[model samples]
Target: MSEADSSTEAAPRGGIRVGAQKFGTALSNMVMPNIGAFIAWGLLTALFIESGWLTGIFSGLKDPGGWVAKIGGWGEYDGAGIVGPMITFLLPILIGYTGGRMIHGNRGAVVGAIATVGVITGSDVPMFLGAMIIGPLGGWLMKKLDGLWEGKIRPGFEMLVDNFSVGILGLLLAILGFFGVGPLVSTFTRAAGNAVDFLVNHDVLPLTSILIEPAKVLFLNNAINHGVLTPLGTAQAAETGKSILFLLETNPGPGLGILLAYTFFGTGNARASAPGAALIQFFGGIHEIYFPYVLMKPRLILAAILGGMTGIFINVLFSSGLRAPAAPGSIIAIYAQTPSDDFLGVTLSVVGATAVSLVVATFLLKIDHSEEMPDLAAATAGMEAMKGKKSSVSSMLTGPDHSRGPITDIVFACDAGMGSSAMGASVLRRKIKKAGFDDVTVVNQAISNLEDTHDLIVTHTDLTARARQSTPSAIHISVDDFMSSPRYDEIVDLLGKTNSAEGASGSPSDGADPTSDSATAAPPAGAVATAPSPTQQALAVESIVLHGTATTRDDAIDEAGRLLVECGAVEESYVASMHEREKSVATFMGNGLAIPHGTNEAKSAIRRTGLSFVRYDEPIDWKGKPAEFVVGIAGAGKDHLTLLNTIAKVFLDADEVERLRAAQTAEEVRDILTEE
Candidate 1:
C-alpha cells in the first residue's frame, strides 16, 4: 500500500473520530492560546463579583474608621466598576479575535471583533458562545470572498477591493448578528441556563458528567466550560455566590487520578512522563497535558468518566460550588474560584474523586501491563516511531511539491507561529549560522501569513499541505517532530555543499562560504573536482529494492544497508554503523521517507558515496513515523551531500514520493532519482 493509503487505514473509523477531531481542534484553537487572558478574567470574576470574598471583605470595610475602610471602599468600587464592563465588552472581543484568527488571519480577527460587538450589545448575558460561532463564520465568509476575487480584480485596485470587501462584510455580519443571531442565541442561552437550574434543583446535576467526561476527552472541555457552564455560573454567582455547574467540567481530580496511575503503574516512557504531566494537570491547570495519555490507552477514559461523576455527586451532595469559572482547571484555580462556605465541600469532593479515579485507573493500567513489557530503550524508540504518523498523514494529503528556487529565506510555518514552529526556526537558524550560511534568513510565520518570497519552508507534517499551498514556489520540508528532526542537519549539509560548489565555480549564491577569507573571494585554480557528480555516483540500478519488508525502524535500516552491501556500495560492517547513526537521531523525514546513514566514524567503511533505495508497501515504523521509502547512504566526507540534497527535494514533493513508491523496476527507480 502507498503511504497515503496506509495513513487512511490507520485513522480511527466512523463519523465519531472525525467529529471529535474537528470539535477538539476548534475548541482548543479558541481557548489554549489565550489561557492567560482567561485566567486573568477568572481572577477578576472571583475577586470582584458582588458576593465574592474580596467584595464582601471590602464592603464590610466601607464603615469609615481607618485606612482599611478607605481601601475597602476603593476595592469594592473597583470590583463593581471594572468587572462588569470587562465581561460585557472585552471578553467577547478576545474570544472573537482567537476564533477569527484560527479560520483566517489578522484581517479575519478584526472583522470577527467587529461582528462580536453586535452580539455583545444584543445580549444581556456575556455572549461567549455567540462570539465563538460568529467570529469563525465571519472569517470563513471573508476567506471565501477573498478566494473568489483573488485574480479577477483589476490591476492597481487590489487594496481598494480588499479593504472595501472586509469593511462591507464586517458591517453586514454585525447587522446580521444584532438582528438575527443575537436574539436567537440569547434565547438558547436562557434555555440552557434553565435546564441546568432544573437539574441542580432536582439534585440530578451529577449525571451531567455522563456527557461532559466523554466530550472533555474529545477536546470539548473549552466548549462546555466557557460556552455552557460559565454563563450559568455567572448567573448563580450573582444571586447565590456560587454554582455547581462551574465545578462540573473544571474539576482536575479525574485527570490527576489518571496521571497518578500512569506515574506509578504504567511501563516505559508513559510512566516516566506521567509524573511531570500530573503536576502540570493538577497544579498548573493545563488539563491538556494528560489528554495524550488517555488517547494512547482509550480504555482509560472510563477512569475519567467515573471520577468526574463521583466528584459531581459529592459536589451536589454538599451543595458545593465556585464563585467563578476555574480558568486553568487546576487545583489552585478551583480554590481561588471557591466561595468561603463551599471550600470544605469542594476540597472534599475533589479529593474523593481523585481517590476514586486513581483506584479505577490503577486497575485498568494493571490489566494493560499484565502482558509482556519492552525495555526502556526499546519502548522509547517505539514511542518516537509512533509519534510521527500524524505529520506523515498530513504530508500525504497535501502534496509538498513546490517549485525549486534560489533559497534566500527559510520559513518555519505552523498553525500558530509562536510555539513549536518558532523553536524549530531558532534551531535551524543557529545551525545555519554555524555553517556560515549567514546570507540566508530564517524566520517563523503562521501558515495563514506565509509569504511566497520565502524560498524554503519547514513545517510540521500536519501543516505541510497548507504551507505548500501558500508558498508553492518554495521548497517544503515536512517533519514529524519539530524539536529533534534530522532534516535541519541535512539542510545545513546541503547548504554547505552548495556554497562550496558555487565558490569553486566563482558563482555568487545566496549562501555565504564559511572558509572564504573575503566575501567575494574566488576559489584557487584546479579547485573543481574531476569526479562525476555525487548524484551519478550515489544512485545505481543495482542498489534499488522494488519490494521490501520491515516491522521496525532498525529492521528497515538494516534492510536498506544490506542492499547497499549487495550492490557493492559498502562493506557488511556499514549496516552496524547505520544502526548506530539511527540510535542517535531518527532518519524519518515527513512525507513517508527516511534517509539512514552512518556516523563520520564509519567513513572508512565506505567504498564510495553511494545510495540504496528500498520501498516498503507495508511501511516500517521509523520512530513514531511510517517510512514507505528507506534510502541508505554510505558517504566519505562531503561527497554524498549533493545526493542528499537531491533526495530531499524529491521527498518534499508528495506526488513524487508516491510515484517513486509505485515504480515497478529498479530502472524506473534510477530514472526517477536521476531526473532530480
Candidate 2:
C-alpha cells in the first residue's frame, strides 16, 4: 500500500469516537440484516391495519366475515393478521436471531431466539429494544458457557453433550430473560419514549438536528438510522399508527438543500457534480451523495443543521409522521409511508428545509472569494481522519493522492480465479479508461497464476501474503471492497498525472516488461476443449437458491458444497476440503460475496469443473465480514476460469447486485447470472 493510502492509520482516534463507532456499528449490523423483515411488516401495516390504505380503497375488506377482512387482521382476527404477528413476533425474533448469530454463529442464534421470545411475551409493546438487548446477551452467555467444556468432552459424546448443554442453558436464559431482562428493557423503552414525547411536546425536537446533521457527515448515518431511530420509531408506530421519529433522520431536505447550494454557487467539481447529486439525494434517496459537499466546506454543516431543524419543525407543526421507516430516506419512500392526511406537511418540510439549507450554504460559498475551490482532497482526508476509516464515497469526490508514487501496471489477484479479483480489475479498468490513461494496464489473475510482470498488485487483506509470495517485487495493495473501492479513483488520478508528465517530456514508460530477463514460455497452440459454459449448466437454475436457509458461514459453505456434490461436480469429501480451505483463509471477497472451494491438495476430490450459487436472505458471518452471496467451486482445471470472469462482470455493477438481491425465483437469478 502507498504511504498516503495508509495515512488513516496515523490519524488520532479519540477513545469516545472509537467506542461510539463500535457500539453503533454493532447495533446497526444487528438490525440492518433484518430490515427486509421490518419492511415486510411495514408493507403489511400500510395495507392491512385498521386505518390502512387497502381498507380505505376497498371498504368491504373491513367486514369481519370476509376472507380479506380476516387476512387484514380486523377486530377478532387481530392476532392472526399478518401485520400484528409480524411486528410483534417475526421481526423481533429475526433481529434477535441475527444478533446472536453475530456473536456465536448458529448456536448463539438459537439461544438468542429462545431468549427473545421470553422478552416478547413479557413486554406489552413491540420488543425490538428488548430483542436487541437479550439477543446478543444470550449469544455471549452461550459462548461463555460453551467455552467451559470446549474440547473437554469425549469424542463419541461430543454431539450429545453439545445438544443437551444448549437445551439446559437455553431453558435457564429464557426464564432469566422473561423475568429479568424483559421488564428492565421495557422500562428503558418507556423512559426513552417519554423523552421523545417530552421533546415533541415542548416543540424542541428540532434541536436534535443540531447534533444529527454533523454526525451524519461523519458517517454515523447508518448507526443513527438503523440503531437508535428505528427501534424507537417502530415502538411509536406500533402505538400511534405513525411516528415522527422515522421522519427525523430520513427527511432528505437538508442534503438536498446543500447540494442545490453547490449547484448554484460552488466552484469547479463541487458545482458540476452538485446538480446530479441533488437528484440522487432527493429522489434516489442516497443521502451519502451530498455528505461530501458539507465535508468540503465545514461551515456548510450549519446549513444542514438548519435545514434539518426546519423540516422537523414543520412536521411537528402539522403533526405529520410515517407508518414506517423511509429506508433510503428518498422522497418516494417517504411519501409511500406518509399518511394521506400529512402529505402537505411532508412536502413543505422537505421544501422548507431545502430552502433554509440553500440560503445558508449559498451565503457560505459567496463569502469565500477565492477563485478556486479549497482543496477537496485535503477535506476528504480530514473526513477519513474523523471516520477512523477510509470513506469510499468521500474519497471519490477528491483529487488523487499526490503522496503515492506513479504506477503503470497493476494486477488484482485472488484465490483460484473464483473471487473478487476479476471484479476489481473490471472496475479499475473502466476508471483507467475513463481517465484516458492508455499507458496503464490493469489485469486480474489468480494469485497462483501470477508472474513477476506487474509493477503493482492488489489483493484481499486475507490473501495478500499469498499474492506477495507470487510477486514479491511488486508493490501490493490490500483492499476490502472490489466493486466500489476508492483506490480505483486514486490510481486513476496518480496515473493521469504520471502519464501526462511522461507524455509531455517524451520520457520512456515506467512499465517495462519484467519477463524480458528470461525466454518467454511458448503459448499452447492446440484448441482447448472445455465443459459447457458454467452458466449453461454448472450455474443453471437448479444451482441457484435465492432464499437460502443457512444462518451461519459454515452452514452456508456446507449448503454450497452440497449443491456442488449433487451436481456431480465433486465427491462428498470435497465439502470437508472446502471447510478446511475456509479455515486456512477467509473466503470473503467483498460486495457481500464468498467463494468456497477446496485447497490445491484436495483437487483429487473434484470430479468436474462446476459452480454452485447460494444467496441468503440475511448475511452469514464469514469471519468478520458478512456474506449474502456464497459461490461454491469444484474446479478440475482451468475450464471454469472463463466463467469466473463472467460472474465478476455480472456482479461488478451495484445496480445488478441490487437486482440479484431482489430476485424472487431461481430462474430470475439464473437469467441475471447469464445476462449479457
Candidate 3:
C-alpha cells in the first residue's frame, strides 16, 4: 500500500482528509501506473515545444548566415504541430481510462475515454482535471445503471440491453462533459492558475512546503503533484514555456539529504537500507521510497521541511521553472524538464536543498541519540515477544478448529498485488515445492480482487481489514513483514502433519503423499537400524542461538560452524571448507534462511551428521539476500539429506520462519526446528 492509504482516516484533518484521500487515490490511479506515458510526453514536449531543443536546432539550421543558405532557410519550424494534439486529445483519454478502470473495470474505461474526448473538444485548455472528474463520474453512473438492470433484463434480450445501456450512458456522459463539467472545470482551472501565478510572483511560493512536506510524508505527494500542481503548471507552462510550480513538489534534494543523514547515523537495519534507498530515490525517480524512513523517524521531517523551503526559495530567487512536469522526480527527469536558461538555477536549488537538509538532519540525528541504545539482539527479541502476544490473542479468539479443512490454495494479497505480495508468493511457492507439498498452490492478487475461493489469505496488517472484507471465510494471516513472515512455516507444518495423518490411515487421497514412495522402499540389511531421524542426527539445544548477531555471511557461517564444533559435531578446520562450498554456490535461500555446508572433501572432518542453527537479530546480507537464519551442516556422506529435507520443511513454512525469528529462547528454537 502507498503511504497515503496508511495515513488517510475517516475523521477529517484540516477539512480535506477524506476528500483528499478519494481524489488522491483516483488521481494517482490515473498517473502513477502511466508514468512511462507521462515521461514520453514530457520528453516530447521538452524537445519540440516553443523554445525547446528541437525548435532551437531547427532555427540554427535555418540561420541566414549558415553555409547551406543556397537550399533556402526553412524559417519558423512548427514544433507545436506534433505536440498540440497529444495534450488536447491523447492525454485526456489516458486519464479517463485509468479513472474509469478504478470505478467500473473495462466497460467503464471504454465509456470514460469516450466521455473524456468531449471534455477535450469543449475546452481550449488540456482538460486534464476535467478528465479526472468526469471519467470516474461516467464509470460510476454506468456501474449503477448496470446494477439496476442486471437481473431485471429478459434473458433473450440480455445482450441487447447491455449494449444499449452502455451506448446511452456514453452518449449522455459525453454531452454532459461538453456542456456542463468542461466549462465549469475550465473556469476553476483558470482561477487556480491565477492564484498560483499570484503566489509565485509575490514570492510566497516557498511557504507551500509547510503543506507539501507534511502531505508528502502522508503519501499524498502523488495527489498534490498530479491533481493540484500539474494542472496549474500546465497552464503556466503553456504561457511561459515553464512553471516554477513544477519544481514545488518533484524536488528530490530534500529526500536525498535525509537518506544521506540516515546512512551516517541510523542504527542496524535502518542504516543498512538507507544507502540503497538514496540511490533509488535520486536516480530512479521513486521519491516514495524515502517516506517510510522519515515515518520511522518522525523528527527527521523537520529536515525535509527546511530543505523543501530552501529549494523553493532558491527557485523563486532565480526565477527557475521547468518546461514540463518531471514525472518520477529523479534528478535526471528534473534536468530533462528544465529550460536551458534555468538549468544552472535548478541545479543550484537542488544542491542547496540537499546541503541544508543534510546539515540539519545530521544535527538532529546526533542530538536525538540520548539513551543507551539497545543491542540488535534484545530489540528483535522484544519485537518477537510482542508478535507472540498478538498471535496468542488471535489464536485464543479463533480457537483450534481445523474444520476449515486442508488449505489447497494460498493467496498473498497487498494493495497493488505487484511488488511485495508477488515476492512473498514466489518465496512460499518455492518453499512448498522444497517441503514436498506439491498439492498446494500459492498465488498473489490485489486485495480488491481477492476471491472467496481462496482457502487461505496472507496480507500485511494494514491490509487485513480489506482482505477480511473480501474473503472473510478464508483463514486470514497478517504479518508486519511480508519478507520474513514465520506463518509460512506453520502452514507447511500443518500440511505436512495432515498428510502424515492421512497416510497413516492407509487410504489414498486426492493429493500424492510426498513421503509415501520413499517410505515404502526396502532398505539394505542394517541400514534401517543405523539411520537416525533428522531431529536426532541434526539438532541439539547447544547448537542453537536465538539471538545470534553476525555482520556478514562469512561471519554467520563461521559462527554456525563454531557452534557445531563446540557440540563435537565437526573438526575445527571445517569452517574453511564451508567457505569453499559457499564460493562454489552460496547456500543463501529465500524466506530469510540459509544452509551452509562443507564441500565433499571436508567429509573427513565430520564425525556425524549434525546441524548448527544460528538466528541473527539483525539480518546480514548473505550474497545480496537478507539472511536471518544460518544452518550449518556437517555430514560424512548421504546421511545429511534427511536433515536438509527437515530444515527445508521448517524454513519453507512462513509461519515456522516467524516462529523461529521470534523465538525468545534456545529451547523455543529447538522445539520449532525439531518438532516435525
Candidate topping lDDT: 2
Candidate 1 global Cα RMSD: 18.5
Q: Which runs of model 1 end up more than 4 angstroms from their true locations?
A: 1-14, 63-80, 151-159, 215-242, 259-277, 286-300, 362-461, 464-676
Model 3, position 470, has a per-residue lDDT of 65
TM-score, ranked from best to worst: 2, 3, 1
Residues 1-676 of candidate 3 have per-residue lDDT tens digits of 2221221222222346446755676687786676666566666667765556665676656545432222221234432354566666777788888888777767688889888988877777778889888888878988788767644655477668767877888888889889988888889888888888788788888889989987876656767888778866876776666889899988998999998998898776667767887888899877766765665567888999999999999999999998778877899989988887898899999998898899898898898788443332333222222122122322221234465567677887755443345445655655565676556677766677777888888775545645655675676666654445687777677666544443233333345433221221223433433565545656788888877766657668888989889988889988777776665344655678776766556668888768888888788787567888887777654444434444556766778888877788887877776553
lDDT by residue for model 2 (1-676), tens? 1111121221343466555666777888888787777777777778877777777777754455655556668866766767778888898899889889878878899988998999988878888888888899888988888768754666477678778877887788788878988888889889999999999999999999988898788767666778889999999998888899999899999998888888888888788777877887788887877766777778899999999999999999999998888877899989888877889999999999999998998888888757568766666656655554445465446544545456677887766444456556756665565555545667666677889878778776556645655565565567767766776776655576655465322332355221110111111322111333444666756778878877667678889999998888899898887877775456676788787887666678888878889998889888778898998987775555445545665666688889889898888887776544
Q: Mind sharing the TM-score for model 1?
A: 0.55
Tell me each candidate's TM-score: 0.55, 0.65, 0.57
Query: Candidate 1 on 595-666: residue-level lDDT in tens?
Result: 776655566788876888888878886655777888887764444543444455566567877779778888
